[model samples]
Each structure stands twice: as structure tokens, then as C-alpha cells.
Target chain A: MVVRVSTAPFDPGAETNAFLAAGRGAGAAVTFTGVVRSSPDDPIIALTLECYPELAINQLASSIDQATSRFGLLAATVIHRYGRLTPGEPIVHVMTLAPHREAAFKGAEFLMDYLKTDAPFWKQETGPDGTHWVEAKAEDDAAKARWE
Target chain B: MKILYFAWLRERLNRGEEEVSPPSDVATVADLIDWLASRDEAFALATQKRSLIKAAVDEKLVAHTAPVAGARVVALFPPMTGG
Candidate 1:
């Protein structure tokens, strides 16, 4: 298990290749990357992800532990970035390895679902007009509830 | 104990964290919020929508009713919107 909380930009391709290469017994590997959304109609200049690093690390570690046990994952890596980011930048990356494809996919999904609603990070978007904190979506909460 | 705030709450409160010492009767997280709201109108306004606020005690997430007696640090923030 690996969890990274960083402010510096990271290369998702490198991360994916490294994770895939490090796999030993697992036959299935899944990497999910979440990128900042850039809309033409509602263009954002920058996005700020604010977090409590120590608390975030603790929460993420526990979440990874839960996903690993629940899905029987062989290996997992989660990298979440905070601070200022531009449109199209990668924000979060999740990688999971398991013996079967189903477990690998589900484990990554579980981590994303948990991070979307419960993790200790808040997103704020700065657009042409102004900066506003992103509101939590009911749909995201519902998606996480499905796992329960 | 130390208290921290985040998001709009941090802006609304005009600061991120502060030291606090509540009365002995302010036993629970809900009680602490009530006590804080009573002491400052900005806090009251910031927490007007109480259900939207989430809290953590010593880096561990907990509900509003969680006790605050033994906590060394308490943080309050809005719902997460990160993936």
C-alpha cells in the first residue's frame, strides 16, 4: 500500500508504468486518474484543492486499508494532489492490483467513491467571473452509499 | 485545545485556527459548536447550516455528538469535494 499527499504535479503515466511494473503475483491491475475538468462554456483559470495534510494522510491510509480488505486487493497506490492546479491537470490517481479483474476495478472505484465525499480535501474553482468553493453533490454521496 | 476551520468557514471566520477552552458543560462537539456560536456571531452565522459542517477530533472524524472532553485538537470544515 502507498499513499501520497503532495502539492507538486506528478506524471500519471510514469506512476502507472511503475505500478504496473512492480506487480508480482497479481494478474490484474487498474489505474484510475482524475483530471481537472475544463469546460469551454464555463472555463476555469485555476482550481485549488485545500487539505489538512496529516489528517488527510491518516484518513487515506484507513480508506486504503478498508478497500484492500473489502476487495481482496494485492497492491494499491493512491496519490492525491493539493494546492493550485490548472484545467486538465491530474488531481488524483488510484491504482489497484488483484488476482481478478473484477477486484482490481472495484477497489479503485471504492477508493474514488470514498475520496469524493468523505476525504479531508475541499475544492475551489477560479473562473473568469470569480472563485467559488465547489459544493458537495448529492449524486456523489449516493454513489458512495451504494458501496454500503 | 486547538480549533481549526476550513473552506468557506475558514474565510467566514476570518482565520484558520485558534485556541479554545470551553466550559466543563460544553462536553460534546455539538455543545462546543453551540458554545462557540453563543460566544461569537460570526461562528453562529458560519455554522447556521449545522448539518453541512463536518468535524474531526485529533485527526479522527466524528459526529457532532462526539465528546470533546479529551480531544487535543478539533477541526471543523465543509463537506469534501475531492476525488
Candidate 2:
């Protein structure tokens, strides 16, 4: 029902509370958070996300609409962060509420899967050596496509 | 036309976006790449690997031969690495 995208740091608890409150009649809420890992194989000192402002938000909204119908969820929320972020920072978060745990879980997973591969954001990793571009993985596309 | 660059493609080109009027002959995405490559050595180097670059016409992914006549936004980038 709600999609919040911003560059500022996020509060997962606040998002969870809002989703739960909005779907009080629902039986379950599932939340997923994606955080940066401290240890990258390469010398990735930090990660910076770049996105085309309008296009990024539009793509996310469209995907959310598709997911809502596929998962039959009562409510859902998606939050994505931009700008420079060090390791261990949360990059994305998704929450879904449904009449049952099964739907909630599936919906949350579906949102993340699509966001991973289909979202319009790009990641750049900076290190002492130099900055390098991250490559998109085929596995993520396949994961998202499974639901289709 | 507005050309936007993202990810490594930006670094490789050493320039984010620039307005260019492709010759009347430039029509397809691949044609644009070839024309862009002729601009300078950097552009040529950046486009050396066509498979590594992904193009979107007016914000939607397009095939290599996709026409770009009225594209408002032409984005060049490597495949997305977002999660």
C-alpha cells in the first residue's frame, strides 16, 4: 500500500509498525532487510548507489503494482536507500502483510526478488585501488522470473 | 537528445552525459555506439566492449537495433548491480 524511497537512513522498526498497523486485520507480516556486508571479496571500501531520479521511483512503483496482484497481499511497504554507504548499512527493506503467513512470506520474497534485478538503481564500489562497477547477476533475474 | 551514463560506463567514458546531434545516418543503438566511438579515443575505448554496455531508449530497455528517433533519454550503463 505504501512505498517509501529516500536517501536518508531508515528505521526498520518504524516501517514494520506502520505496516502492521495498516494491516491490523491481517494475520501476519513479513519483513526483509538487505544490509551491506563488511567483507567483500574485493577491496570494496564503500558502496554508492546511483539512480535516475524519476525513472527509479517509477520502476519500483510499477513492480510493486505487479507484485501486489501476484501475491494477494493486504498491504506492503518498500524502502530503498541511495547515496554513499559503508559496509553493514541497510540498502533495502520490504514488508508485506497478508491474511496468512504463506502469502506474507511469498509477497515479501517476490518484492525483494524483483527489486534486486529489475530496480533501476546502480551500485558502484570504491576501494583503495580504484572504483569498479558491479555486474548484474543472471541468477537474480531468474529468481524474479520464477514467480512469473 | 539527453545521454545519461551510469555505473562503470560513466567511469569509462569519463563523462556522464552530453548532447550530441548524431549525423542523419545514425539510427540504431549500435549505430549510435559506432558514432559515439568516433567522437574520441575515450569513447572508442569505452565502447570497445559492446556486450558490457546496456542501452535504454527513453528509460526502457531496447534491443541493439532499436530505433532512437524520438528518444528523450538515452542511458548507457553496464547491466544493473542493484539489490
Candidate 3:
């Protein structure tokens, strides 16, 4: 598993290509990208993400380890970016490779769910009104609980 | 020991990190939070919603009941909204 936490934006296509190239024998691959969203009602200008870098990396690595073991994944990578991001920009990318399609799909979803609840990155949304911190959703915690 | 705050907790406290000795009575994370809250009004406000607060010891997530005695670094923050 590879985990990257940075302020720089990354190309999801390129990341997927690189990951696929390395997993030669893996029969299935799944990839997911999370983007900063803005709605017509809210009209957000940007999203600012703050992170505890050391802890984020450590927690992501541990989550990846659990995903791999549970799903029998051959390879996985998670790249999460912090700092201010404009709407439509990618905020996170997750890719998983496994011997079978079921494992590949489930692994990616598992990692994404864990990231939503456990990763130590906080988001603040900026808009015409001003900036306010995003609240954690109850649905997200429920999502994570399913895996346990 | 070093204490770190992040997100709204950092905003409320107006500082990201601080060093302090909480005496021997602060044996657990819950005890530590109560101790910190007593230091000032800002801390009291920040920790007002204990259920919304999360903690880490030496960068690893732990429960409020977790021991804080030997920890060199402890972080307190709001529930994560990442990914």
C-alpha cells in the first residue's frame, strides 16, 4: 500500500495508469477520486483542508493495511491533498488491485469509507457569506461502522 | 508533554500547540480534558462538547478512557471531515 499526503494536486489518470502498470498479475483494479463540490444553493468558492500530516499518514497507512488484509488486495494507493482547493478539483484518489473484481471494488470502497471518518483532515468551506468549518456527517460514521 | 489542537479546536484556543504539565491526577484523556478546561474559559468552551472531540496519543487514535500518563504528545481535534 502507498499513502501520500500533500498540498499539491495530482492527475488521477496518471496515478491509475502507474498503479495498473505495477500490478501485472492482478486481475481486477478499482479506482476512486473525490472532488471538491459546490452547489448552486451554497455557491462555495473554495474548500480549505487542514491536516495533521504526521497523524494523517500514519492513520491512512493503518487503514490501508486493514483493507488489504480484509479484502486480500494485491496493491492499494491513497493520495490525499490538503490546503485550499477550488471546486471541481480533485481532493483525494484511491486505487485498489486484487485478484478478483469483488475484492478490488470492496477494497476501494472500504478505504474511502475509512478515510472519511478516521483521516485527520478537516475541511472548511468558503463562500459568499464567509468560511465555516464543515461538520462531520452522521452518515459517514455509520458508513465506517459497516466495515467493522 | 506537548499538546496539539487542530480544526475548530485550534481556532477556539487560538493556538495550535502548547507545552504543559497537568499534574499526576490527569491519568486519562478524559481527566486531561477536564484539567485543560479548568485552565481558562477558552479551553472550557472548546471542550464543551466532549462527544464531538476526538483525541490521539503519540499520533495514534485512542479512546477518552485511554491512558495519558506516558504520552509525549497528545492531540485533540474535532471529528474528521476528510475524503
Best by lDDT: 3
Q: Clash number for every model?
A: 0, 0, 0
Question: B9-69, model 2: which lDDT tens digit per residue?
Answer: 7877778899988887888989988998888788889779898777888877677899988
Ranking by DockQ: 3, 1, 2
For candidate 2, give the lDDT of residue B78: 74
Clashing residue pairs, backbone N/CA/C < 3 A, model 2 = none
Task: Give the winner by DockQ.
Answer: 3
Query: How well does candidate 2 match the true structure in TM-score terms?
Result: 0.87
Question: What is the TM-score (0 to 1) of candidate 1?
Answer: 0.98
**Per-residue lDDT over A5-66 for candidate 3, one digit per residue giving the tens place of the 0 to 100 score:** 99999999999999999998889999999999888987989999999999999999999999
**Candidate 1 pairs with clashing backbones:** none
Winner on lDDT (1 vs 2): 1
* Cα lDDT, all candidates: 0.93, 0.81, 0.96
Tell me each candidate's TM-score. 0.98, 0.87, 0.98
DockQ of each: 0.86, 0.60, 0.94
Instruction: Quote the lDDT for A49 in model 2.
Output: 92
DockQ of 1: 0.86
Q: Which of 2 and 3 is ahead in TM-score?
A: 3
* Candidate 1 regions with alpha-carbon error over 4 angstroms: none
